[model samples]
Structure formats: C-alpha cells, structure tokens
Target: MPTDHPAPSPRPRGWLSRFDTLRVKLFLAIAGANVVLVMTAYLIYSWSFDKGLVEYLNKADENRLQPMIVRLAEGYRQNGNWAWITEDRQRWQDLSREVLGTGRMPRRPGELAPTPPAQTPSDAQPHNPSPQAPPAGAPPSGPPAPNVPPTFTIDPRLLLLDPQRNLLAGPEGRTEQAVLKAIVVNEQVVGYLGYVPRLQMVASLERVFLAQQTRTFAAIALGMLAAVLLNAALIARWLSRRLRVLGDGTAAVAQGDYSVRLPTRGHDELAQLAEAFNHMATSLQAAQQARQQWIADIAHELRTPLATLRAEIEALQDGIRQPDTANLDSLAQEVSRLTRLVEDLRLLSLSDLGALDYRFAPLDLGRFVGHHLNDAASLSGTPLHVRTELEQGVEVRADGDRLDQVLNNLLQNTLRYSASPATLQVEVRRHDTEAQLTWEDTAPGVPPAALPRLTERLYRVDESRASASGGSGLGLAIAHAIIEGHGGRMQASASPLGGLRWDIWLPLNPEPANA
Candidate 1:
C-alpha cells in the first residue's frame, strides 16, 4: 500500500541571491577591484619593508663589528696573550654580551671596578649566580632556566674562535658552523666570529607590526569598496525604480486605463520618456472621447433619414397618404440624403484603407481655378458675389478630378453657409516651391474655438442648424484627406475679409523658364 506523503516544497534562496541584481553586480565589480588593489599594496609594502630591514641590519653589522674587534684586542693587549679569554667561558660570554647584546660588561671582560674586600659569614653557602641551567642530572633547584642567547634576534647563532680555529665562547652543540666574519685589529687577524648567515633582523615585534599594516590596508580597501557599493546600489535602484514605474504605467494603458499619468523627475532620458508617456495617455483619452462622440453623431444623422423613409412608407401602406408627386418627391429626397451619407462614408473608409486610386498629373494651378470659377456659374446654391486674382504659370502635380472635387466641396460649403450676397475672394499664388490657394468670404465666420477641428469628420460649424441645406458635413473632411494624400495641407481660419477663410497649400516644383 502506498502511503499518503506530502510533496516537498522548493528550497528558499540564500541571502546572497537576494542581491543578485544589476545594482549588486555593479557593486561586486568595484569590490573585486578594491580587493585586487589591497593585495597589490600589501605585496609592495612587504617588499619595501623587507628591503629596509636588510639595510638596517647591514648598517648595524658594519658599524658594530669593528668596535667589538677593538675591544677584544684590547683585552688581549692587557693580558699580553689570548689566555685571559680562551680559558674562561664567563670572560668570553661577558665580552660577547657587551659587543653583540646591549648589556654592559667590564672594558676588560674579567675586570671589575675597585671595591674594598669583605669577609663572608661562616654559615653562608656558595651560590651559582649565572643564568645557565644546572648540569644534566643535578638536583632540580628552585626555578633555574637556560641562558638567554647573545644577540637581540633569534637568527644569529654566534661563535668566537682564535685564528687557529680554536673555539672560545659559543656552545659546543653549535661547533660545526663556518666562520662568518674575521675579527681584525689594526690590520691583523687575531680570531674569527663564526655564525650562521644573518642577512636581516626581523624581530617578533616587527613581524606583528607588518601583519597589522597588512590588515590596515585590507580594512581600508574594504571600507572604500563598501562606500562605492552603497552609492552604486542607490543609483541602480533609482534607475530601476523609474523604469518600473514606466512599465506599470504601460500595463495600465494596455488595460484601457488612459487616466494614468507619470511624474517627470530629472531632466534625464527617463524623465523625458515619462513626459512623452503622459502626453500619449492624454492624447489617447481625447481620441477615445472623440470616437464615442463620432458614433453618437453618426447614429443621430442616419436616424433622421431612416425615420423619414419609414414614416413615408408607413403612411402610404396605412392609406393615410396617396402616392402623389409630392409624396414621391419626399421619398426621393430622403433616398438621396441616405445615398449621399453612404457615399461619403464609403470614401472616408476607402481613404483610410489606402485603396483610393489617385490619377495624378501636372496642372497649371491658376488656370485650374479660373476654369472651376466658370463651371460654378451653372450650379445653383446660396448666392455669392465672387472675385478672383489668378497668378499665372503656377505648376503643381495633383489628381485633376480629385482637385476639382475638393474645390467644389469648398464652393458648396461657402454657398450653403454664407449669408445671401456673400463676398467671396479666390486667389492663386506661387510661393517658392509650393502653390497657395486662398478662398475668403465675408461674414458668418466660424467661431474661434470651432476653427481647430473644422476639418474633422462629420463636424459642422452650427450644430443647431438643419441638414435641409444638403450636406453630409464631410465635405471639408474629404477635402482635407485628399489634400493630405497629395502631400499638402488644408486649414480654415478667420479671413482678413471678416469672414471664414479656407487656405490650401499644394507642393509645386516651379515651372521651368522655357515653358
């Protein structure tokens, strides 16, 4: 039978992994560099320290050796022979201490300052005052210890010997070492100072001090690195924090929350990005509102025609109205209104889908305007007093039919909206590399606030006005789209003639002089 056992959970990460981010990585790199710096400093210090120590030992050796040789030869001259030092271990040991060690001894090793001789008590026992240990198996006296070495350091094992290589001072256990230096007195070699090679004196205190210096260097390096790590971490964390805010804002936007706005901090790249994002969000919100308004307006416009058609049909079927010419004409008018709205919408959709075929060709802009003016004489609409000043030889590349359609839409709007007997001015001017067309009319100018969005789709200057004037309110919008497709601009402003002004700019590469 299988037992019911719980599955094991994944292990938690170690503390080090918690800092495994860009911030920590940058800090670690600096820390590694600091460690290398510390090691290099230590190695360099050790080399210099050892070199200085050797120099000090060599100077001490050179300065101290001659004094010691002179003192030993003086002892020999006083005794008239080597017998005074060679036969006595105490004499040799005392002389060695005064020379190599810092302690004082008699100028002559065996001699002492004059003092009056005194008799000792009969019951007094003799005592050995020297520091050397008692003979091998002698009685264990109270706390006797071995003698201290002669030199200040442990490395130099000393032996004093005659010119004949006869040992005098050092321990017999170290008799096998070679002669390290010959003692010279007045250009004569009397004896030799045999020792192990002593290159430098590195005392316990100096070793401890060197170790402390190394630790100090390491500590300073670690401290400096820690400071850098903290600063770097803060910088990285700050950058990441700003980016996280941007990421969260973008996510909110994707979720259809356009109200989210980010704060711009410094004048850095991230700050500029935040500013752009806020602008984008504001635009998106405005566009969404516009989209909603467009839907409502379309529905309202379509309903008007649809309701009329339905009402007319119902009236005829219920025997309320006969199919007279008047009723039939009313049906035809509604059908026509519906047709115009559909066609306008179809044009807009086609333009949006980039499927509109434009047959572009070069045209004389001034002549084109003059011809359109003559053609407008046959069309019936609101009356206008028209004037024209056409600059000749203004050449431009455009679709002639589309350009004609744009001018017709503008003329129709002017005739429909302007008061009767409107003053109209149409002018074509060649300005450098572009053609400028201005159509300004008198009175009934568009409002200041409404001017900005005058070319927006389905927008009208007067909302309370009736649609009986025969326009889908997309004339200027369609014209604007066409101009944009032709790489031009179309805008409406308050005319200098105290009326609504439509300005159109078309790109032109000026007609050649020969033509």
Candidate 2:
C-alpha cells in the first residue's frame, strides 16, 4: 500500500541567486572598482615611501660624515702625508670618535645604536668647571635650548680611502656602492671619506612609524570603500525599485489591465518612461472602451433591421398579414439598409488597412463640384434649393470615383436629413496650396458638444440626427477616412446657414509653370 505524502513546495532561492539582480550587480561593480582603485593607490604610496625613506637616510649619512671629512683634511695638512693614520689603527679610531663626538668605538654589524644628544658648552670645558655650568649629566635648568639639526648614527657603514680610492679604515669590500665625499685642504683634494648607501630602513622608530602609517592608511581606505558600497547599494536599490514598478505596470498591461498607471515622480529618464507608460495605458483603456461600444452599436443596428424583417415574415407565416406589394417593399427596404451598413463597414475597414484603391489624377475642383451639384439636384427625392459659389481652375490630385462617392454621400445626408425646401450652399475656392470646399445647409444644426466626434464610427446625435433618419452613422466616418487617405482632412462645425457645415481641404495640384 502506498503511503499518502504531501507535495513538496518550491525551494527558496539560494543566496547567490538572490544576489543576481541588477541591484546587486551594480553594487558589486562599484565595490570592485573601488577595491581596484584603493589597492593601486596603496601599492603606489608604499613604493614611493620606501624610495623616499632610502634617499632621506642616505642624505642624513652624508651630512653626519661632513665633520669627519674636515677632520681628515686637517690631519692630512698637519702630517703632509698619510703615514700617521695608515700605520696606526688606534689613531684612526680616535680621530673618528672625536670627529663624530660619540666617544664610542665603531659598532658591529646588526647592532643598533641610539643617536647621541647635542653637546652643551660645559661639556667642551670639562677640565675647568664654570659657576654657570649645570651639574654633570643633569637636565638643563633654564629656557629651552635652541632647536638643533637632527643627527644620525651611521658610523658602521663609514670607510676611509686615499687619493687612489683604496680603503684605509672601517669596513671592507663595499666600495662599489659607496658614496665618497672629498676631503679638501686649501682648495686641493687630499683624501676621501666614503660610506655605503643605505639600502633599506633600519631604525626601530622608522620601522614602527611606517607600520603604523600603513595600518592607518589601510583603515582609511577600508572606511572609504565601505562608504562607497553603502552609497552604491542605496542608489541601486532606488533604481531597481523604480524599474520593478515599471515592470509590474507593463505586466499588468500585457494581462489586459489597461487601467494600470505608473507613478511619474521626477524629470529623469525613468520618470519619463513612467509617464509614457501611463499615457499608453490611458489610450489602451479608451480604445478598449470604444471597442466595446462599437460592438454594442453594431449589434443594435443589425438587430433593428433584422427584427423588423423577422416580425413581418412571422406575421405573414401566421396568417396575421398578407404578402402584399407594400409589405414586400418594406422588407426590401430593411434588406437594403442592412446591405448598405455592411458595405460601409467594409469600406471603413479597407481604409483602415490602407487597401483602398485610389487612382489619383489632377481634376479641376470647380468643374468637379459643379458636375456633382447638377447630379445631386437632378436625383433629389425632395426639392432642395441649391446655390453654388464655384472658383474655376482650382485643381487638385484625387481619385474621381472616390471624390464622387464623397460628394454623393454628402448630398444624400443633406437630402435625407434636412427639412424639405431646405437651401444648400456649396462653395469651392483655392486657399494657399490647398483647394477648399465648404458645404452648408439651412436649419437643424448639430449640437456644439457633438461637433468634434462627428467623424467617429457609429456615432449619432440622439436628437435631429438619430437612427430613425434611416442613417447607418458610418457615412461621415467613412468619408473622413477616405479624405485622410488622400492626404486631406474633413471637419464639421456649426454652419452660418443654421445647419451642419462640412469643410474639406485637398492639396492643390502644382501648376505646370511652378512645377
């Protein structure tokens, strides 16, 4: 028998995966750059410090050996030869001790000797004690002594050489790297004082100071790096939060939540993106609402005609009405109305898809309007008083059949909707580079609020321009689309004649001379 077991839930993301987001990546990039920069600076500072310390110690050694050079020169002057120092090691030691003022023998290798203190005036006159002298080795009791130059203990590396550069005293076999100071007497070179150049820091205080400084610098670098990391993390988190909001908004829109809006807080690119997304969402919401309204309108329009036909046919089948000429004619009219609505919808779709076949050719606007006016007058079911103000030679590039269709639709609307014996005023003129046509009818003007949406598909005024006028409401919409496809525009407004006004603008064909 199988035991009942619960399903395993999803495993939580590992720490590494959790840090794989853009925020973490950005933080790491900033931290890595700071690390590289700090390490490079530390390495460069250490190298420079080491080089500068070696140079400083070498210079100090040269200064300390200066007094020794003078003493060696004075000895040479007195002796007039090197026999006194060369033959006697004890003489050389005494001369070096007296000149250096340390009163000590030369130190062996690896031995660290502290620098001797500066000499007081009393120390120079030890044989005769003065009344002003302080007790032996007691701290001075008076105003502080004047600042003295620093002295270094560098005797272990000291070497003496003759004019020929042969070592005479001190250490041996270090001549190659020794720095020699000339021992001169009366402007004539006699012998030389030399010492080996310092290769590394040897003083305990210097080594301790360098180590402390290194630790301090390392701590400062780490502090600065920590600050940079904190700043980077904050910035990354802020950016990531903003981006996540946008992502959520986009996802909502994808899921058909058109009402989703993002917060636009600043003038940055991210803020601009949020604003654009909000605008797009608003447009999508409006389009969605319009689409639903359009479907409802289409259904209502089709239902009215279908219901009329169905009711009449059912009456005849139930023997409640006979199939007479008037009854058949009523049914035919409903079918015709349905057919027209379908055709108008198809035309609008074609225009939307850019599939409308337009054969463009230059046609004289004046003559074209005059011909259509005559045709409309001859075919009018009710008497329409027509007036025309045609400007001759006003030409435009347009499709003749399409232009005729537009003109017929306009005339039909005027004849069907306008009161009988209504006066129709038509005007054609040239306005700059465009041919303008204005059609105005007398009385029954459209409402002010309904003027702008006159070209919207399936939209109708509920008062004088209602569906009872036997209009499919797609005529003006189709006309608007056709005009737009021809690179022109159509507009409606309150007419001066107290009816609806239609303004049509078509680009004028270039004159042959101007072309």
Query: Which lDDT tens digits does candidate 2 get at residues 35-96?
Result: 78877887898779878887887887777778788767766775576666666655566456
| Model 1: pairs clashing at backbone N, Cα or C within 3 Å | none
lDDT of 2: 0.81
> How many clashes in each structure?
0, 0
Task: Give the residue spans of candidate 1 off by over 4 A.
Answer: 1-210, 510-515
The window of 10 residues in a row where model 1 has the poorest summed lDDT is 135-144
Q: How close is candidate 2 to the true structure, as a TM-score?
A: 0.73
Best by lDDT: 2
Give candidate 1's TM-score.
Answer: 0.65
Q: Distance from true position, residue 478, model 2, in Å?
A: 1.3
Local distance difference test, per candidate? 0.75, 0.81
